[model samples]
Every structure is written in C-alpha cells, then in structure tokens.
Target: MVEDEFATEPFEVAWAGEARWFLQFLSEGAGEVSVRTQVSADGLVWVDHESPALSGPMRGVMTVPVSDFGHWLRLVVTPSSGDPSSLARVYLALKE
Candidate 1:
C-alpha cells in the first residue's frame, strides 16, 4: 500500500530478538529518485541509517543492509527531479 508521500509506515522486526535486516526496493519511473533507510527506538524519533541506500533513475532493484537500527524501521523516498506521479515499491525482510 502507499504508506506515505515521503516515508513508509513504521514496521517492527519480524524476529523476536536482535537480528539483521535488509530492505529491498523495486522501482520504475523517470527522472531522479532516491531512497534511504531510517531507524527509531521509540518510533517517535527517527534517524537516517546511512547514505542514500538507492539513488538514480528508479528502474531496477536495490538492496541495502541495515545495521545498528533500533526496533523500528521505515523507508524514505525522495524525488530530486522527476514526474511527481512516479511510484516505487519497497520490501523488507530479516534474518537471524
């Protein structure tokens, strides 16, 4: 579902305890699009995990490993220059 215009809905880890996580994104559109991962401990204060996890003319798949993320995670997508009607799909998974 379309979570948000700038960010996805906060989601909890699938694992019960501390575990590694990865975010995969598949997008197709024109112009320049960028995506980054964010983490939050309380779900109220969020912070960017690393550099732009994925960036460019969204037209392929990209995977980014998330480390040091708190208990919640989300995605932030930005369009540097592109049709405002562009869209992207995101997927999240975890491994213990």
Candidate 2:
C-alpha cells in the first residue's frame, strides 16, 4: 500500500494490550529510505521513535519489536526519487 510515493506507505496496528513484535516485508533498491516505528497511547497523539527501526538500503527481512502493546503503530519510508511511483516500487507485507 503506497502512501504518497515521495513519502511512504503508513500502516496502523492495533494491539490487544499484549507485547508483540510487529513484522513486515521489505525490499531493497527502493532508494535511500528509512523505516520509523511509532507508538501511540490513544491512537491520536504519536511519539516518534528515537531512531528508525530500519535504515539504509534494505538487505533482507527487517524486524521491529513492540516493547509493549500500543493503541497505534505506523511505518514510513523515505524515497530518493522525486517521482512518487518510483519510490512506491518497494513493498511490505504481514507474513503468515
């Protein structure tokens, strides 16, 4: 799900008040990109992570653990390309 092409597709996760690691698929050569995992208490206000869960060129699978259940979770990617579609080449998935 491509969000803005220039920015990145953002996803929200709702946990049932349990600690779990949120996993997703990632691709390489998408361009200079970074992945940010943020947590929200009420799904309204969000607190950005101190650092990106994943950064630099993607190599393989990237994993981000949720220390605690959050009302909301979001992931973002930064594209090097000026065109949005070009940045939308990469894909992320929730594996079974």
Top candidate on lDDT is 1
Best by TM-score: 1
What tens-digit string does per-residue lDDT give for candidate 1 at 19-46? 3333233435555656788888878889
- Whole-model lDDT, model 1: 0.63
CA-lDDT, candidates in order = 0.63, 0.45
Off by over 4 Å in 1: 1-5, 14-27, 51-53
Q: Candidate 1 at 64: error in angstroms?
A: 1.6
Question: Can you list the residue pairs that collide in candidate 1?
Answer: none
